[model samples]
Target: MASIGLMGEQGVSAEAVPSLHERDLLLRRLADLAVLPPGRVTPQERALVDMVMATAVSRLDVAQRCRIAERVAQLPEGPRELTLALARDTIEVAAPVLAEAANIQGSDLVEIVRVTSMDHRLAVASRKILPPAAIDALIEYGNTDVLRRMLENRSIEISSRSMEVLVRRSASEPELHAPLLERPELNQRLALLMFWWVSSGTLRVEILNRHAVERRMMHIAIADVLEGGLAASGADEALRVALSLVHPPATIAKPQLTRLVNLATLGQREEFVMELAREARLRPETALRIVSDFGGEPLAVLAKALGLSRQEFGDLIVAVAELRSGYVPAKSDIERITAVFDAISTDRADLVLHLWDWSISGEAQFPLPAEE
Candidate 1:
């Protein structure tokens, strides 16, 4: 990659200044013409553009240089050399072009990001469509300020893997919770987990309700009932699950589990998990790791592995959620949870089960400490 050389190092001959001045005047006139309804620019104005490029732009003062970049940034055939130099210039000179330049390509943007200041990067964050390579660079190079700008810019597209990393980081980023919640792309399961880990603000309820509504507005009534149930129930159930270290095969039958799901009682949910851990060939503590989670994906995965019906999976979602929030799961909550359960392929669930067992005994412990 060739370097975009620093401007103004080699001064232009004094003879060029008069010609450069004329070119600047011509450019300003042409730029003014560009904003009005379509009309042909005079041939002299056209020659002025080419003539300005022929001059050493670096000899121009900062104000004059920035003016050139601002005008060119908006034009598709605006001088590439001019834009490139300005993008690498001081933040004030670069910001407008970086933020709104229609002609700038991803490669130039990435280079600018690599070499520019935070303000410049923030400008890059607002671009309408970022290439994967550029997005990757932004995620790595951006600091907290740049990241906030990027997240807030709806035009930015963060890849799935980057989102996962952001979600994990959100566990510790209290300031980021609201933005992450407002981010519609977040998977509900991860969003729920984030909500649990963050503060006990009213925003939690609002975001959760919004999440539910977005998932399926039609189910809002049931969700509201369950959410209302939380008020009636109180957070008294500090739901805890304690089970024997090991269990005999198939001791807790399907009917028992079904009844447990139906009653949606605290003890029953705990007992159901204990039996389920044994069936999934996971330790009670390890399996409880999933059940105690803030989201329903792990629970859905376990329910799928256990061969539960779709309704049973829905029950598990409602039961755990109600016990936690002291309210019924919202309509969106039910729809989201059931959808996750249905989406899990049997093969994936089984692989997850095996991996869970192997991981627990090998290099890893359950990630979130099992509170229960």
Candidate 2:
């Protein structure tokens, strides 16, 4: 029965402009309708109220619109068009609904994330329940601040793909490291990949403690295959990598230990990788990962697995440091690396190395069976 026009458009008629009192009255009625029990308002009545409120909302000042948003955010069911209008408003008007509205569709939230400001995206990230698509949209468009909030939300389950994106991004934005590690969705594969660049000792320990699982079930499942010679020759590379973890050969050809150090110091990465792979009985690619890792823990594990003496381990650390230009290992860095090497026995280091082998051989999709 009434017409509402845009507030400042050229073609507005004076009669169509609602006074502030009328606008407040409309918002009050909308708020009233929002809290009504499910059946109290008929569908047609609700639609009419929604239409009136949506039109009037745009004309209201920010504070009034914000009050409506805060009110609607608490309702189990609110007018869809009105909620979306408020959600698309400025952050002050949008935050409440974006973060708490129960009836907002996942798709609508995704749309808001795509077109909204950082504050708007942050509000969406703060929601207690984020759908996968919405989570993906936030990761795709959000910055480190948004990601930190989402990763710390703990109420959401991040998909594997989103987790991968965050892990890769964390290489550059170290601020994401703690929150990302805190996510329950973070699995061993991701944690290990993150091991290369994560800077803190605590986070590094968190990764190793949570992810360095022994493949006990896999060891049992393939014990017969190995004994029967199935895995020795004809088995897939994944199986071979798995088999190595369970039963390392009695003797690996030992490279002259000093030569390994010399190659690493000279930045002859290819030769060092080749010799380390041969000595550690690992694939060359896995060896390359050890040498190329930005953190020293992987190299530490390799040294321990190869039974390097403390003096030799120290030399290897210096040599590896030489590969990265202008990079010098602090005393703390060497101490942390040494602590890691000393903490893990040779057997455990060997298992970690084989796990890397399995991961890098493109067989991580065939994940190791959960330990029984």
225-337 per-residue lDDT for model 1 (tens digits): 64454455554422111111111112336876766565456546677667666666566655766767655556766677677777767667777665465655567656666
In candidate 2, stretches whose alpha carbon ends up further than 4 angstroms from where it belongs are 1-18, 215-221, 227-269, 292-295, 309-332, 358-372
Q: Which regions of candidate 1 are displaced past 4 Å? A: 1-55, 201-372
Worst 10 residues of 2 by lDDT: 3-12
Q: Give the whole-model CA lDDT for all candidates, comma-separated.
A: 0.59, 0.77
- Model 1: weakest 10-residue lDDT segment is 239-248
- On lDDT, the leading prediction is 2
lDDT of 1: 0.59
lDDT of 2 by residue, 63-140 (tens): 667777887888787788889989999988989999999889989988999999999999999899999999999998
Q: At residue 2, what lDDT does model 2 achieve?
A: 41
